[model samples]
Target: MAFTETTARLTDQGVMAMLTSAVQAAGASGQPQCIVIVDGSGVVLASFRMTGSRYLSLKSATAKARTAASIGAPTHTLPDHAKAALAAATGGDVTGLKGGLPIRSGGVLLGGIGVGSGSGEQDETVARAALAAIGADDI
Candidate 1:
């Protein structure tokens, strides 16, 4: 697989618009949030941190996005799908912690989105809303 640099790299503006819409929705709920999007190689594509969002939210969201993109699995699917082989292969860093989801388009994996802030359930809700806004299927 080839690695692509996402720092200042171009991406689909429509996807970004969808992500921002989701973040705004979460904020409208009166909660701060950290949102991160990663490409298939686990490269940070886009990131946003709402005002008053917890500092730790940045790292947590990054972890969730990376986990999903690296494994082609949703973070919520981890606990039940824990396999020794996967752990060993991933060096034991996979977290099925409930707010990470892969972004799929037309059956093709585009990237992954992870959200943190508020709470775990809230994070998932925000991310799911973003994906829905883009009509992206979750992996």
Candidate 2:
């Protein structure tokens, strides 16, 4: 038997930049959000909760990140059927929320980021800001 595999991954610096940018975006919008980053394997790499954010948002943020990383697509962009099926398959471990976005670089899947605590659109805005910070917003 032989096994060989390669995968893209986010560096620690990338995580920091992402979190910082997302937080700033949320603050500018007058919202407190919980931000989370997950690796390609759906394991959390980093996370942050703003001082005024609701505690439940932490779980929502993590689920969003895991959904994006596991499905390799932005949560909000998934087709309706696909989102339903994925949610059922994951038994709610994944969420099809607008705040989740896959992180890619050079056409390679690296990880995902998620933000919560505000409306879906607000959360997505913060996530996009984080992606833009690293020039990964094209994905």
Candidate 3:
């Protein structure tokens, strides 16, 4: 059977806006954070790390973003079994961490967002705030 696939992508403006929102959220929460946005194919679009955020969090943030984009879903919402399977399959490049979420709008997938350098809940919160800024939080 022949099939066609289509996907949405966030513009550079959108990426910057999300990053700004995440930084603002992290500041409000008094937590340093690293934020990363990836395209639908898991390519880094933009990233930022607040002062005092751990250097290692850069990798974590990218992994989370890539995981979400690859699966077209929020990393935190994946079933444990699915998480385990994906981790095994991706050799750890993809994670089931709560900081990652697929960026969707009007039911169209538009890449992903991830936050790091905080607790799981905090990271997720920051990521959500980023999505909200882009008006893509409904997903």
Per-candidate Cα lDDT values, in order, are 0.76, 0.89, 0.89
Model 1 poorest ten-residue lDDT run:
5-14
Taking all chains together, each candidate's TM-score versus the true structure is 0.78, 0.89, 0.89
Question: Which residue segments of model 1 deviate by more than 4 Å?
Answer: 1-10, 80-93
Q: For candidate 2, lDDT tens digit of each residue in 54-136?
A: 99999989989988887888888878778778778878777887899999998888888989999999999999999998888
Candidate 3, residue 64: lDDT: 95
* Model 2 clashing residue pairs (backbone): none
Off by over 4 Å in 3: 1-7, 82-85
Comparing 1 with 3 on lDDT, the higher-scoring candidate is 3
lDDT tens digits, residue span 12-62, model 1? 784686578768778788888889888877888888898899988787788
Q: Cα lDDT for residue 53, model 3? A: 96
